[model samples]
Target: MDLESHRFISYFLPDQRPELCHSATIEKFPPGTVIFEENEKPDALYLVLDGKIEFSKRGGLGQYQNVAWAEENDFFGEFGVLDGQPRSARAVTCTSATIAKIPRDRLMDILERSPGKVVLQLFHHIIHYLRLTTEQYVNQMVHKHKMMAVGEMANTIIHDLKSPFTGISLANSMLKDLHQDEETQEWCNLIQAQITQMVVMTEEILEFTRGKATLNQKTFNLGESLEKFQRLNFIYWNQHNINFILRCDNIILNGDENKLMRVWQNLVGNAVEALDEQGGQIVLIAAKLGQDALIKISDSGPGIPEAIQSRLFDPFVTYGKRGGTGLGTAIALSIVEAHGGDITFESQAGKGTTFYIRLPLC
Candidate 1:
């Protein structure tokens, strides 16, 4: 039904003066046109006469999340118009559409002249809309609470394992001195390496669960740190026949060296896992981009899977890797962001994935 023939509007139009009724104007908008934005004062009430309109709220990083859709016979922007308040969400045309816009002043004028029946119908629609919104909000809150509970439980369990891992690390260190045979010594070295990895993993989990990463800031050489990490992982990378290359100038940095090293460890480790012993190349390029240190890690692996790309940095999001807790990227992101920097990546299904890390240069 068109706006003039709309039940609520038609009920009141008979009592309104002709000019007041004429104040509702028909507006045409092309696809992707924004009708209104959140926080803007409502000027008019819009009723969708044809095509579709989407309502969204801004999410993290300037993303817009769809809250609802209005199609034929649906009226929007009424809440703000009635309350004389700012819009709670943004409205945009999803497709080429025609909408009827009733100016707020004209709407109030019509309601003042109309009988109690017209106001009752308006109230019915508003109450129904509010009920649905409340239901959605409650569901979100329940889901958030469930996630918090699971996180608290996981943090306790992970915290309890730290002492036992420390004991195992100490024992692994002592075994190196006790075993003198060449073959036995090599095996002990491997065990010690694995224990070291476990120690790093444990630390990452604890830090993530705490939600606040404390940095031990100091001036250090970025290039030297990369070289040392590559050296330490040389044997592991070579075992998979993966060619690892580091091309970086000796850039000095002022940050937490240990935390930054952990970021590198996680990124490099993920790249290696993506390669999966099929012999691919991983390159670490560290260069200066004006006042920022730009570091890019590119891998010629299969690339990140499409399913988890949106929540890639969210904790406990993992793909097909065995024994994966999925906290590596999350921890890496936390550390980098804590240092007043950002991390982003580009990936393609068949080609490869590249991660870019930008940190303020000192």
Candidate 2:
């Protein structure tokens, strides 16, 4: 392989200086092999000569989330090598791969010996890395500002609506005693129901905007919790013709029942939207796995779309849905994580999706 042809290696030298190339060694790894892991010290920078490598970060539970992929001619571990910091993410071989392992110390010594072009190229690489890092930081800041702006606007609207909602509710209560007519009584009841729903929506919005969830932890039977949850959402589920097949081991868990219920509600609600009015089966299965509790929510609906799959849990990321504030999964994630649990999922585009929640067993 010619070192000068690739952007990363080329930036360290103008051409394949036999002396510089001689300092590096070639190594090969088979598929499924971990080349480096998160928090490990960077000993060398790697240049992918063939096949592919996957970069990932540890996610909730024992799973890893894909960050990016490295194809032939790509390089990684440079940032850690330059800064003398631990690896920011893990690298694993996606296929049988050939990699050029350039020891940072040897490469630095070679560059120092070459007084002209080598030093200039090294300077250019550092500047480019800095520029890219700055751009990413600015983008994140912009996104954060946008979220804050939207949240503040929503909070104001919900606050203003509360006063009128209170007045309407009071009038409905007063009119209830004045009239006993069946049709009139029905109308009053409908209005009260709508007002109650509005209040719940407002509260949910406030909770999401605060971006904090405190678990009301306690020991409770998982089966009993599911029963109460079923009763609470029976009306909506029945109206949509959605079937829930609950299989529980009746395991006792120590966590906030209400918050965990919220997690289930969010997952099932999203599944319902995917299923539409056609109706589908949602299976809730809970079991004990060693010292942890494993719960899976599977739905026979069209699975999540590909475009937003990588960022599915990110705040404000939503698919094609009407009147969606896009905070449901984000809130669910916050609540589960607060209870020292992790959430992950598996989905096929046209098939279905299964969400897994893992929490420590008490």
Q: Which candidate leads the pack in lDDT?
A: 1
Q: Which 10-residue window in model 2 sums to the lowest lDDT?
A: 11-20
lDDT at position 270, candidate 1: 89
lDDT of 1 by residue, 228-312 (tens): 6776788889998989989998799999887888899988888888778687999999999999999999989888998899989
Candidate 2 error regions (>4 Å)? 1-131, 157-211
Task: Please report the TM-score between candidate 2 and the true structure.
Answer: 0.59
CA lDDT of each candidate?
0.82, 0.79
